[model samples]
Target: MKKIYSLLLLVVSCASFGQTIYTENMGTPTGTTLIPAYSTGTAPATFQNSSPIAYSGTADVRITSVSSGYTAASGGGNVLINAIAEYFQIDGINTSAYTSSGLQLSFGINTPTAVTNLLTVEVSTNGTTWTPVTYTPTGIGWTLATISSGIPSSTTLSIRFTSTTASQFRLDDIKVFNFDPSCTLALGTPTAACDAITFGLDTYTVTIPYTGGTSGAYTFTPSSGTVGGDNPATVPVGNIVVSGVTEGTGFTLHITKGSCTYDANAVAAIDCKPANALPFEDKFPYTVGSALGANQTWANANTGDSILAIAGSLSYTGVTSTGNSVSFVGTGAECQTPFTATTSADSGLYARFLINVTDYGTIADASTTYFATLTDGNPSNHKGRLFIKKSGTQYQLGLDAASTTTNFASTLFNVGDVVCVVLGYDFAGNTLKAWFNPTLATLTDATTPDLTSTPTTAITTLGGFLLRQDSATLTPTITVDELKITTTIAGLLGVSQNSAIAGLKIYPNPVSGGTLFIETAANAEKTITVYDVLGKQVLNTTTADSAVNVSSLHTGVYIVNITEEGKTASRKLVIK
Candidate 1:
């Protein structure tokens, strides 16, 4: 019983290897004969009438007749006869569909049980050369035989049967089967981008292509990074989404379904996170031919050159704003200024600039016309921008970051409109805030900001600030003036106190000489403190008399703080 069970298992295993590519039977011949047989090298099999032997059909393929080739019939109704030293061929069989498990050419043959070496079978790709195939016969009525060795790798193939010794042999029911397992797999492209503080979720969807194998659960494995949502997720028939992760590089998808494993191509990307700080400002107050004032200068951040000549189009326009303002024009033209910290402890920073769009000719919108930008050395590493654009008949203001843009407001200005733009950078929080068209004089008191964006990449350092119009034909004329960089909200908004300090008065407010007089209601001893525009305390002194000397102070705006009898008052002081 055990031997019978083992034999049954072998027969079942052989029967399971049935992915048939081609089949031929001698029934119902066509063309010039009753049966159609594929031929090669001038030898083709023919249909013969059933008589003595039939292996389940009334017709058999005959290679040659007794009168033509001097061979005896094998007496099988559905069989091919091969005489000694003569061969018959069956061509045009496609072997490309054969899988890695290999292929087998199967047929039923009837020959004398004693005739062990009756015939030899060979397979070929081109027909001139051939490889011999090993045949195993079951030795029963209409026995099943298979030739599985030396099968050509080519997609198109031919097989020949040749008789060796003088023996009657016939073939019928020719079939070819391949042992091909299912489930071939592949993956689609993944998603990538920079990190944003507000929206940090990056998503990628990969597809799996599979068919007709084991029906079971599928699993995915990443090469370098972890899968964002789920690990070893069930295989989706369509696609799967990988979400909720920071910037990653060199990610590859590996899929497994049952016994098959597939590895996709590796994908690489950049998700940067750098730090940033602020409290630096540029007013562009210089003469037409003078070098950019003191520590401030113009540079081409994109091209790495000093573009500070007085003869070029990016020089000071000599249009005085309290003194003068700078102008920029032409395509891809830009001017940048370096940042200097106003105080030693300054970390976060904000900047306010006045922009007057004088003439914009034939310019459509701000999609390509990047008028102002903040960067860290490389222009490609853009932190933020104030984009002036025209939408239809109305002009608009667009606040932009590395990955997203926010259209904040619409203005009434046609071509010539002066607008105030304020930008704040929070280095610790990785966020950018902006205010548009607010009065610069009272900006510190403005409660609401227009727009805000959180970036995924870190804005590590304030390398420079830039101004340009990236258009050639659309020559938009712009004038920039009254720029201020500061760390405090009061400094950024130009906060000033104009009222007298409780019956105390400072006469000749714009003190041009070396001496200025101070008067108090009760002639009390008072301590005076002066702060620069950047909120830096430059002078602190106590005075008992009515007069104070201010001879050494520079020509600029200063905030004066007066304290007397536990009372403190603040006011703006100017020196000329």
Candidate 2:
């Protein structure tokens, strides 16, 4: 075993303990890290003047005696005998390849004989100056000597090894430190996108490319980015289509002086997407569907579906009674308490109710609160034979039992009539119009109605209409098929065509217990596929169809992949 001890040196009668680690005669470091290169393995020789040993790259570091020198492996140069303190200052280490925020330097020593006269160990930056450290001796075996500090701070520095023999050190585990700063932004949480994620234009525009200490390229996907570990993308911006990423293992991202940079030992990447490339608010009308349950049938099966009345009555009638009051609740798709609407966006709501005209009468009572209540309704009030309780009292918008009311022309809806009762607010004219069977009898009001004395609240007490017959004593027995309430006119009008010039759509989206509908932006050769979470393809349809057979798929979360004209779009599909 080689025993390493401190050497005392005297300079001008001042005696101090000193250590000599390494000395290297150098060139600019050109080899890569951990890829078995010699450029990153050289260090400058050091001499202790009692002020703790340190040296620059110009200092001569001889690893073997010139008389019995060592060949520089299969590369160039030779290793000569001299103090080894300068070996600590290697070059070409990009430092960006280290994971997280720190660097690690690890190497081993091998000798023809059991050698152990090991002295001091150190690391440096710039391949010139170095920092010396003490090496503790363990048992007889040569274990890996690892020092984890001095990274980023000493990135340009190299490693130093001091010993009395010409043995070679098996170098491995070289790394960089402090790659992740203490002030890293906490903005990488995964979230579902609604409007495009805009980083407030001009917030972040530079891209850092990390290509060392790792082996592959990085890829940013629609929702996330993948590093060597396949984790979600932590890019600063929310939305942009960039490229120049390779797939590999062991990757890192770091920031310095307000600029981001990345490095990997075996990977290369460049920013392909531009900043703020696409930004536009989605203009689709707000939609809603009935609360899901086992015993419910929707006239329009779209969960976010809207029913439209194009000059006709849109009525919902249940074929049979399911013994349960078919009702709609204000729950969105996630079944989460629908996000409270701050404005019109939050007001996207609707209902689902059971309507049966057979054994029992269907009843709708929005009287969940006290300010509003259901009252005697007569359809003659609006050319229809239904009376409704409005605001503080019952106000009618129809003709006096004549049903001659209309929004456009002179179409009269008579008593005992049938019409689609559409209550929609016109944003353009700012009026609320109620259509009776499209146009037979229509009523228009110019003010937002106050259904409660607490005028600030909605008309919650107006929905439950008792379908009673015969003296009004017996509750009318009938089934109600569907009920929907929306803030947009188009949402209430269930039919709207897409006119955008993009090949993206979801079909049979308002899916029920049948085949799935797949719509395309244009007719072209496309690849329609469905995948589960485990990267397994559940369904693969290669033809072009507006609607596809999905009755064979089991109910669960499915990702529908549509590839047309080299553009791809994916949507989530649910089956119930």
The candidate that achieves the highest TM-score relative to the unseen native structure: 1
TM-score of each: 0.34, 0.22
Per-residue lDDT value at 336 in model 2 = 11
Give the lDDT of residue 86 in candidate 1. Answer: 54
* Stretch of 10 with least lDDT, candidate 2: 9-18
TM-score of 2: 0.22
Error of 1 at 559 (Å): 20
Number of colliding residue pairs in model 2: 102
Candidate 2 lDDT score at position 25: 25
Q: What does the lDDT read for residue 136 in candidate 2? A: 42
The digit string of per-residue lDDT tens for model 2 on 277-307 reads 1111111111112222110011111122112
C-alpha positional error of residue 443 in candidate 2 after TM-score superposition, expressed in Å = 10
lDDT of each: 0.51, 0.30
